[model samples]
Target: MPKTGVLIETENGGVKAINYGLLTAAMGNKENEVIAFITQNDAAEAKDDLAAYGVSKVVQLKVGSGDINSSPDLCARALAAAVEEFELDHIAGLATAPGRDIFGRLGAILDVPLVSDIQSIDYGAETAVKSHFSGKTMATVKLEGSPVVFTVRPNAVDPVENPVDAETAEFNADVADGPKVTVKEVKASQQDKMELTEAPVIITGGRPIGAPDNYKMLDECAEVLGAAVGASRASVDAGFAPHSMQVGQTGKTVSPNLYIACGVSGAVQHFAGMKTSKVIVAINNDKDAPIFEKCDYGIIGDMFEVVPVLTEVLKASEEK
Candidate 1:
């Protein structure tokens, strides 16, 4: 059996929810031995959670030279050392900003090809499926080298529980810091909202939202659903929402399980970003809006009127 190493991402000292799905993908019909690798959090605390998704061994990687947190090169070098130390056949991680940075550097360090933001993988075949041409096509790519490296889109795979007893180990890598770049400081997001790409559910507003303060409506509904709030490119361009919250071809690509679009006109650019959502619900006053044709469910009404009722209904259901 091939040994697959999954780079586990953590938040607040716990494994991120999306890592479980990556673990599921690494499992691959129970034919591959899944090893969980973590850098930021305590391996012992994450072992049980990782093992619930069939990870048998959890490795905590530490660098003996410089701070891996401050240097992406150092982090990649340390991970490369671990890949060699463990003889990992494949290395996988989430395709977040940090993941992309480290994996890009790691690919250069290892002189190997890196495929990123893939929707699915066949570990046994060393192949992955990823979107191309602005989400219009999907290509199955075959990796042709030792220790294939790839990053999967968050929430692309459904997590399945396959419990196992896990053991933890520590790997201390002695890697020299590169002189290229060192991060000075990192700023956390001011809003304590779920990350747009990692969120399982997202509620988005469009140009018709009118004002920035009006986003409170979406925020309230998002809070009730435990979802992230997003804005269409039109809303962002109109100054009703920030660019960071924008979801479209020029913005963040999301693959949420449930995507709620309010007052969005279903432009191709916006559709390209969220086309992978499992279920899409659209609310608009125009019954013949293009969104109605693309959405799984359609509500023909003004978002101002439909959203409050939806929020109240969700609240009442939660109360029960």
Candidate 2:
């Protein structure tokens, strides 16, 4: 069986739920050995969670001098070392911010092809599907070289649980700090917050949301659903929400399990970012809205009326 490695990313000292999907992709019918590579976390602590998703080994890549979070170069070098040491046939991870940084560097160091933001993959065949031209086209790419790198889009694959007994190991790579870059201190703009990309459910507001304060309704609904709140480009441009919350062709792409678009007109740009969501529910007053055609479910009504009732129903379910 071929051995595959997954570079796991953690949040708030716990394993991110998104990594399980990558693990499922790596395992692929239990014909391959799944090894999880972790940095800035304990292998023993993460072993149980990783094993739940079919990981056979949990490796902790450690550095002696500097923190891996601060030094991307060092982190990449360490992953390269692990890739070689474990004889990893393929490497995969979430196409998150840190994964993009480190995996790009690792691919450069190893002189291999690195494919990012893939929608799906056939790990056994070393092929994947990626979006192109603002998601209007999907390109099937074949990875030709050995030990190829693939970064999957978050929530693109549903996670499957296949329990295993994962063994833990420690590998301290000998990597030196680069002269050009060295992180001094880490400052977080948003920590411990539900991010739009990784959240399983997302509720997005559009231009008709009216004002920034109006997002509270969505927030209440999101709180009930354990979801994150997002905004369309129209709402952001109109100053109803910040750019950080924008989701569209010009903003961040997301693939949550469930996406709720409240008062959105269903512009192609906005749909491009979240078309891969498993289920989309659109609430708008216009019966002829374009969103009705794209969404799995549509409600032709005022969001101000529909959203509050939705929130109340969800809240009531929890109380029961």
Candidate 3:
């Protein structure tokens, strides 16, 4: 069996939920040996969780001289070393900001082809499927090399449990940190906010949201649903929301399990970003709005009136 190494991402010393989907992708057909590689110090804590998703081995990768989290170049070099040591035939990770940076550097270091933001993968064939042309097209890419390196889009694959008795190991790579660049400090705009790309559910507001404070309605609803709050390009452009919260062709692309769009016109640009959502719900006063055609469910009512009721309903259900 080919040895497939999954670069596991962790938060608060525990494995991130999204990594399970990456594990599912790496498990492909049960024909490959899936190994989970964690750069954090809590691999032991993550072992059982990873094992539940079919990981047979959990490796704690550490650098000799510097912290891997501090230097992307060092992290990539350490991962490369681990690949050589473990005889990894394939390496996969979540296509998050850190994953992209580290995998890009790893590809350069190993001189191997890297396929990024892939939605699906065929491990045996060494092929991956990814979106193109602003999500208008999908392309299947084949990697012709001994070790296939790629990053999967968050939540692209549904996690399937195939429990195994996993073993834990540590790898201390004798690599040097790059002298040029080092991450000084990582700051979050909202520390408690969920990242939009990785969120399974999202509630978005459009231009009709009037002012920034009105986003509180979406926030309350999102809080109840354990979802992320997003804004349309029109809202962002109108200064009602920030660019970081925008979701469109020019903004962040998301593929959530559920998407709620309030007062959003079904523009192609916005649709391109969230067209892959499993279920889309649109709430607008105009029954003839373009969004009604694209959404899976439509609520023809004023968002101001409808959202409060929805929040209360959700709250009541939670209390029940």
RMSD for all candidates, in order, please.
1.1, 1.6, 1.3
Q: For all candidates, what are the clash counts? A: 0, 0, 0
Give the per-residue lDDT of model 3 (tens digit) for 80-158.
9999999999988889988999999988889989998999988667688999988899999996666889899998899
Candidate 1 lDDT over 142-216, as tens digits, reads 976688888889999999999999999999988865637799888888777788999999999999999999999
Give the higher-TM-score candidate: 2 or 3. 3
Candidate 2, run of 10 with poorest lDDT: 174-183
TM-score of each: 0.97, 0.95, 0.97
Q: Can you tell me which runs of candidate 2 are displaced by over 4 Å?
A: 190-192
Q: Please write out the lDDT profile of model 2 over residues 215-289, one tens digit for every residue.
A: 999988999999999999999999998888989899989999899999999999998899988999999999999
By lDDT, the better pick of 2 and 3 is 3
Candidate 1, run of 10 with poorest lDDT = 173-182
Model 3 pairs in collision = none
User: Model 3 segments beyond 4 Å from truth?
Assistant: 177-179
